[model samples]
Target: MGDVEIRPARSEEYAAAGEVTVRAYDVDGHLAGDVGYDTVLRDVARRAEQAEVLVAVDGAGEVVGTVTVVLPGSDFAEISRPGELEFRMLAVAPTARGRGIGEALTKAVLDRARTLGIPKVVLSSLEGMRGAHRLYERLGFARLPERDWRPFPHISLIAYQIDV
Candidate 1:
């Protein structure tokens, strides 16, 4: 991860970060049969307005991965409680996979939570995203099965949380 830098995305980089996010999800088949969510994934600027939009940039400064960090009560936050920070749309470009960009970005979120004096960080992931599930587990996130939910008839999201 030495060549990657995780930081809050700049206004000028919103389009690039959004494209990286959309491309990652599209490549991973996470968007199949899902219509409108793609628009949400591509709206980094709007999310940045209400949440923190963080990007992983390679040494040359290309946005290769992005994640949205939502605080309690934000429109982008789904399952987060008052003391928890929720992250959404965690994505790493297919071409940039295996480079630890996703893990680094997630760690950055955890660091952000600690910096804000937040106790826990939470997130929702599709049940089929086994790779991400493994990563979350490796980072000590426990499943909150009782919080699992379906936003749309075809979409089922599982929750996870880790105390920071």
Candidate 2:
């Protein structure tokens, strides 16, 4: 964990970026047999066209993490609206855990929201991702209970937001 560079993902890194995402969820047991969603996680190239795809790279120039910053009307956006930006598919390589990669990637999204003059930033996290919840809360994102939702019957997504 040395000199992590937070920046937009290069076109060539899209495939590796997708692997980082899918692998993180798979490792954490979050990839619950949802073929469509799993396929979506592997489509960072497609996501890049609809939103800003940011990556956390190590000193060795390896992609260790990624997150998609989605604007209000982007296809990946869920809880965001006018004056708000939402981030999705945050993932950090399992081998890179404890290196602050996830936090750095999240801050990149927050930074983007600030630069865009957005009033708020929003995101949805799977309820089972307690570790992610801690990081989100530590970064000042408060739970937005009313925005909680479920895309799948058994998988609940909890919302969080922060005024920027």
Best by TM-score: 1
Q: lDDT tens string, model 2, 63-147?
A: 8999999999778888888999999999999999998989888888888989989989999999999999999999999999999
The number of the candidate with the highest lDDT is 1
Q: Which stretches of candidate 2 lie over 4 Å from their true place?
A: none
TM-score of each: 0.98, 0.97
RMSD of 1: 0.7
Tell me the deviation in Å of residue 117 in model 2: 0.4
Model 1 stretches with alpha carbons more than 4 Å out: none
Model 2, residue 141: C-alpha shift (Å): 0.8
The whole-model C-alpha lDDT of candidate 1 against the native structure comes to: 0.93
Report the C-alpha lDDT of model 1 over 1-164, residue by residue, as the tens digit. 79988999999999999899889888889999998888988889999999999999999989999999999898998999999999999999899999998899999999999999999999999988999999999989999999999999899999999999
